[model samples]
Target: MKKKLRIGILFGGRSGEHEVSLLSAASILKAIDKKKYDVVPIGITREGRWVTADDAHALLTGSQPPENPRLAGDPEATPTAAVIKRGEAIIVPPVPAESLQPLELHAAAELSPARPALALDVVFPVLHGTFGEDGTIQGLFELADIAYVGSGVLGSAAGMDKAAMKKLFAAEGLPQTPYLAVLRSVWRGNPKAATKKIETALRYPLFVKPANLGSSVGISKVHDRSELAAAMDLAASFDRKLVIEQGVGGPGAKPRELEVAVLGNDSPEASVVGEIVPGSEFYDYEAKYLSDASVPIIPAKLTAAESKQIRQMAIEAFKACDCSGLARVDFLMEPAKGKTKPRIYLNEINTLPGFTSISMYPKLWQATGLPYKQLIDRLIQLAVERHREKHQTRFTRV
Candidate 1:
């Protein structure tokens, strides 16, 4: 009999998007095919502490695990034992051990009975921001020589920082909005000088964002000099680097928000285009997660030529950032004026995008003929394939 693969779903991270990550993880836990896999739930607290399966499940669903979980095609099998304590931290050793070792840090002094280390065939990280999505965790996975989902270190890091992503896009000759990267120190040291530089280089109605954040957590829209100072202050509080982006479209017109999901490695494919109609003036954090008025249009209405151009640009943006596994490339299309065709500009690429059931990444793939479960399966397969390719490299002298 073929042994079922053990899959680890890692979630809850130290980031502004922590709650959003929890929602994404819950959707995956419910939708994943448990019949063909032994699903293990691993979670990290906001304080960066890793917890066991039962604790992780409880944290996610606010309920305890069943005394015995049903195995695939078996009703009379022996009960599976819990491997680690509920609150104990699970450490991924830098050395290649292929198992997550649990550090016993409980108050009790005695050691427990011998148990096998929790082995994972592959890790699906639903962590959405900072430490989890910004290449730190990917680096740890590389050190452990484990197969995991999403882009590698460089891609993840570049995708997380807006300044770096825009630079890469420019280097690839992809069309993008004008923007400036400002260090928090420089801005704070001379607010007048920073304001002058930004105003001189870009027009009003600019977007102020923390370069290293996702989910629009520290993003602000500024219309004039008075608004710029406050926006800079808000963005500077979140990150050391800030990105001021020029807005698209003319007066009183909003640019259309389009997104395309890219999947695979080496040779990647672009999904059907989707659009977001922001409930607010722009797609801020509140309008994205908290508001109920925002709407998502799958297979966004566009001319065949427009769709093809945006889709191709999405793939180009993905490759330019060296992304793998999956990414959602965003673009802004200026409002058509005086019978002229609208211009499309690549906004950014999200390496590890939102994975909630309703998130655009999965929805775009679904609209492109791939279901959510199948999408997860494909991502896991890609992770293993990439790991195998990495193993082929010669790290030492022959």
Candidate 2:
């Protein structure tokens, strides 16, 4: 009989997107196929504490883990740690430090029964930003040599930073709106000079964003000089690096928001295009999650040629960012106006996009004939395949 694969669904991170990640993870826990896999629910608190089993359940349900000794005495109920080394997720006693003082403790601890590892076959990190979505956690996965879902370290880092992603897109000759990257220190050192430099380079109606954030958090649209300072300040609070982009269109026309989902390891396939009609002036954090007014048009009304071009561009952008497993590529398009063929610009690529029902990434694939559950299955398969291929590489001279 085939053994049920042990799958770990990691959620609730230290980022501002923690709540959103919890929602995404909850959906997976309810919908994932239990017959084929043993699901492990791992939750990280906003304070960065990792919890599992009953503790994880408490975190998910808004209940605090029992601190009273009477309520927390079960040894098995204790929070278990997940470690990836020797190519599998395990829960072993942490190796002691190499220093002499710690070495004595290590020697003494070796006499005790080693804690059995959790043995996760694959980990699906539903975490959204900062330590989770950025390359930090991905690097830990690489060191553990375990198979996990989504892009590797390089891709995750690049995808998290808008400035870095745009540079890669530009190298590939993809069309994009003009923008400037600002460092918090530089802006603070000389606000007047920074304002002058921005005024000289771009026009009004610019977007200020924290380069390494997702879910439209710490983002603002500024119309004139007075608003730029506050917008920049807001963005700087989230990240040291800031990205200022020139608005896509002029006047009453808002640039059409289009998204395409790409799936696979190398030779990925692109899903049908989907359009987002934001409820607010722009798709702010409130409009993306808090409100239900936003509308999504599947297989967005586009000409056959435009659809083909967008699908192709989506794959190109995914590769340019070195993404694997899955990604959602966003594009800004100007509708065809007298003599002007619709101009499409590669906006950005989201390596670990939202998985909620209303999220565009999964929705785009569902529209392309791949159901939600099937999409999850395919992604797990891709992670296994990629890990197997990576193992083939000879790390040491053999």
Candidate 3:
């Protein structure tokens, strides 16, 4: 019999999307093919602890329903102090001394017992936001010389920052909404100056968002000048930079939101377009994960030409950002009025989009003839393939 490949399903990260990551991991754990792979579930707590066994089990079981797998540990267990060394995650006890100086010992230093390693062949980082989605962890993976799912450092960082992402799209000649990027320090240093700049550059009814966050955590829709200060404050609290975008619609017409999923390393393919009808005034975090009012229309009602244009644009944006594995390219479609045709503005690319049951990334692929389980398998394969290809480059000249 062929030996099973040891696959690590890493989840529960130090980000606002911790719960969402847990949910995504749980979905994968339930669906992942057990016969072909030896699975190890690695959990990272909000305190930034890398844990396995009981601690990881507790967190996963506690967050999941009774029907899911439960562990033999306290539901509210304290996290352990662990670190990754030599490609293995080890639980290191607290250092005894408070001094920052290096210890001087004449070959008399005590050594701790060796901790067993997970010996993972590949890692599937189901983490989102900050340390997870912003390319930080991907950088670690590259340094550790391990294969992991999703984009590399460059693509992840570019995809995470809205300002940088828009610049890349513009360079590729992709159509997008006009916006202004603001610094939190600049806004706080001179509120008058920042407000005047924003007002002068863009119109009212703007979307204020934290440049480095997602899931609409620090997002506000300001209708007028009176609401701009509050929105800026809210966004500044979340990130060092804030992005204020011009709203897509006019008067009473609502901007229809559309999304297309892209998958692959070099020659990526785009999924059939999907439309989102938000339940709230905008598609905030609550409407995305909590409420049932929001509806998703698969193969969104579009003319053949419109569908072809958006799908092709989605692929262009994905490559422009240097994304791999998978991404969900979002757009804002202005409703056609009079002789004016519908205008599609490339919103942004999510290098690591949601994978929950109700998430659009997986659903788009399911509609495109790739089921959830097969999609997960394909992602893992892509990671290994990308890693192998990357090894071909020589670090030093002979």
Candidate 4:
């Protein structure tokens, strides 16, 4: 009999996409192969507390953990005691170690016991946005020397920031829309000047976004100067840097939104292209998670040549940012007019894309012949492979 690998499923992080992360984690927890791996549920609160135990799953799923009988009837009593009793907060040591240490909180000292450290073979972070996906947690994993899923620090940071991602795409000679990166301070310091600079570089019908956010949390489409100020304010509230991109299509036509999933390390492969028909004006946060009207077309309608070109571009964009393990590369295709072929522009890459059951990342791979379970397995395998490869390099002078 073979020993089962203990995989820690880290979810529910401190980000705007925290709820989305929980949804993704729930799907993974249900779908991951149990026979091959011993799954450990680790939940991080919005306040940044790391917790683990049987109740961790419950907490992530938004269910009430088993409460103490003594405090069940007390209206003023909080569930904090029951949560601490059922779940133990954890501390991941930066130095390479085999297990996670339990954090002893003074409030729950009596309720919680000092237990043996929890051992983990690998960490599958289902976290999204800010602290989790922007390389902060990846940096911690690097310091801890743990094999984790998704891109490394540099890849994650660059991927999260649209400005940096666009620069990388431009350097790789991959086609993308014209855009300007503006700082919140500069925009606020001289609104007229900042607006003038953006107006000069890019035309109206622009997309304004926070450079460091995901799931379209702080995104707005501005049609003219009337809406530009409001969009800038909204974007600036989410991130210090804003990426203002020129819209691809002309007149009333909307560009086709396409996506490709890239998987592996060293040599990566792109999945079949997929298209998103946004329910709203754009694939805003509401359309992505809140609404049920948005529809996804797998193996998007495209000519063989066009599909091949976009797929290759996706791989190129992924490698340009030094991404490993997995990523979902997005693209915008201008509507073809007359006899001319449509032009494809590479959009920003998502290092840690949503992994919910309906997410395009897994769906694209599934359409490309890899099912959800096998995709998860392959990602874990890639993470371990990358970790081993990294260890081969000499860190000290000979």
Candidate 5:
């Protein structure tokens, strides 16, 4: 029999999106092709404890942590940065050897484990937000010389920061709503001045967001000066910087939420357009995961030409940000009510979009004829292909 590739599935990270990660990982773990791959479920608890199990899906979906998280050499208590002298963890070779074989160390050093949790052929990080999605974990994968699915450190960090992404989009001649970014220091030292700066740049009904987070953890739509200060404070609570974007899809605006999925490396392809009908005030955390009321319109109701144009724009947006593996580019469509030509505005892109059964990313692909299982296979293949390309690059110049 051919040897199976050992894939590490990481989920339940230290972020507001912990539960969301688990859901994504659960779906991925369920759909992976076991014949071609050996699954390794490594879960990080809310307190940051690392645990391996045959049932990571259950642990993640349920509210409580695992019953037997402590392996023989597993630590008595979990550490934040993960010092695995004695814990349900394994060492991934941070520095590489000339021959390219990674050093695999177990927690007990005597477990005789079939495969050390750390020595993965590739990793699929189903984590979102904070350390998980914002380049920190991606950097770890880079240093450990492990092949990880999704964007690299630069792309992940840039994608996490709305202000940075906007700057890149602007430089690429991409259209974006007017916005302002404020630092925590400035807000704390002179909040009034910070508020004035925001007031000066954009109009009211602005969306104040924590510059580095998603799942709408800290976001608000401020209609007036009275709410602007409070909204900034709320966003500042989640991250050091806060972003305020002009309200684009409200009462007077188009109010359309469109999504496009991009796949592969250098020459990525865009999937047919999808639409989101948020179940709440907007696509907030609860409306995204908990609510069943929200709906997605696959091959969204639009003219053939309009759909083609939106999909094309989505690809440009993905390339503009130098994305890899996969991304979901979201846009807003301002349809003509009577006289004006309809305008399509690119909102933002999610490098690591949710894989919930209801999430638009996977749903769009499934509609494109790739089932969940096949989609997982394709992504794993992409990871290996990308890794091979990187391996061919020489580190030192003669």
Candidate 6:
């Protein structure tokens, strides 16, 4: 019998999406076949504690870990300074006229490497938003020399930043709506100038979002000039850079939410399309997580031509961003106005989309022939294949 792959399922990040991450990890944990893989669950709390247990869900659901004191990088902004917040890294020497101690640091203890932990053949990160989705965890995976599912550092970073993703999409000739990026410095230093640029370039009813957070945590729809500043402020609080987009939906004019699942590395493939009808005012966090009213139409009832076009477009978007393993590419289409061409606008891609059975990514795959368990199996295979390919490259010269 082939040795069962030891897969580490990581979840519960320091992000606001911590709860969502727990939900995803639960679904993935349930779907992975025990006969084929040994799943080790790793949970990080919002307060930044890393732990693994038979009761992994408890840590996440409890928020004791909070994954609090999490360490993440934001290239757009530099870290102020490394301050020992907690744990053993926070050590202080004896202050016998040589040192003064603080409450956070103890004089007796010394920093030591965390006790050796079991190595993982592959890891599946169910974490979302911020530190989890924005390449920080992926970079850690690279440093550990382990194979993991989803995009690598570059792809994860690009996918997390809607502003950067849109620019790359435009450069690749992919049809996209006009959008502007608000740098942290610009928004903080010159609010008036930033507001003018947004107002002049785009009209009222704009979508303000944090460039690197996901799950619509810091997203607001601005209806007029009066609401613009506040909307931008809410978004900027979550990230150093913010993305402003022209709103597509209006009263009774529902923007069709279409999503396609892409899988594999290098030569990747796209699955059938799925459509989501927002249950609330829009597809906000509540509509997505809290309410169960949203509808997901599989293989989205569209003309053959429309389906094929979207599948191709999904692949194009994936390749444009150099995504690997998997991504859920979302779209918004203006309803066909009296038989005119349906205008499809690529929204954003989730590098590590939700994995719960109800989530669109796996559901699309399930409709396309790979069942839940098999889909998880295939992702593990893809991880191994990607890792093997990595070994072929020459890192150091002889």
lDDT of each: 0.83, 0.81, 0.81, 0.83, 0.76, 0.77
lDDT by residue (tens digit), candidate 2, 160-244? 9999999999999999988999999989999999999887888878889999999999999898898999999999999999999
Q: What lDDT tens digits, residue by residue, belong to model 6 across residues 1-398? A: 78777788888877889888988898888778888876677776555545564335567466353232323222211211111111112212212232222224222233223422244688888889987888977876775567888899989999998988998888888887678998878998999999999889986678899998888898887778898888888988899899998866443566788999999899989999899988975688888889999888998988899888889989999988988999999988886678687788889888998888988889999999988888888888898898889889899998
List candidate 4 stretches off by more than 4 Å.
64-115
Candidate 5: count of backbone clashes, pairs at least 3 residues apart or interchain: 2
Q: By lDDT, highest first, what's the ranking?
A: 4, 1, 2, 3, 6, 5
Worst 10-residue lDDT window for candidate 4 reads 68-77
For all candidates, what are the clash counts?
0, 4, 0, 0, 2, 13
Q: How far is candidate 2 from the true structure (C-alpha RMSD, Å)?
A: 4.6
lDDT for each residue of candidate 1 in 1-398, tens digit (9 for 90 to 100): 88786778888877899888989999998999998777878776665655555668776875543333321211121112122111122432222343344322323323232322356778889989788788988886786677889999999999999999999999999999999999999999999999999989999889999999899998998987889999999999999999999999855679999999999999999999999999999999999999988899999999999999999999999999999999999999998788998899999999989999899999999999999999999999899899999999999998
Pairs that clash in candidate 3:
none
lDDT of 3 by residue, 1-398 (tens): 88787777778877788888888888888888998887777787776655655556666876432222222222122122112222233332223231222222212123222324445678888888888889977876786677888999999999999999999999999999889999999999999999999989987679999999888888998888899999999999889999999889754557999999999999999999999999998899998888999999998999999999999999999999999998999999997788889799999899888887568999999999999989988999999999999999999988
Residue lDDT tens for model 5, 173-261:
87777888889889999988888888898887788999998787888878889988888888888999988888875545536789999
Candidate 3 weakest lDDT stretch, 10 residues: 73-82
What TM-score, computed on C-alpha atoms, does each candidate reach?
0.89, 0.89, 0.88, 0.89, 0.88, 0.85
Select the stronger candidate by TM-score from 2 and 5: 2
TM-score for predicted model 1 compared with the true structure: 0.89
What candidate 6 gets wrong by more than 4 Å, as runs, is 54-57, 61-117, 249-252
| Native-to-model Cα distance after best TM-score fit, residue 366 in candidate 1, in Å | 1.0
Best by lDDT: 4
Instruction: Summing lDDT over every window of 10 consecutive residues in candidate 1, give the lowest-scoring window.
Output: 70-79
Q: Can you write out model 4's per-residue Cα lDDT over 1-398, one digit (the tens) per residue?
A: 98897788888877889999999999999999999998888777765655676556777769744442111111222223222223233432222242234323334333334343345678899989998889988886776677889899999999999999998889989999889999999999999999999999998789999999999998999999999999999999999999999999854679999999999888999999999999988899999999999999999999999999999999999999999999999999998899998899998899999998789999999999999999999999998899999999898998
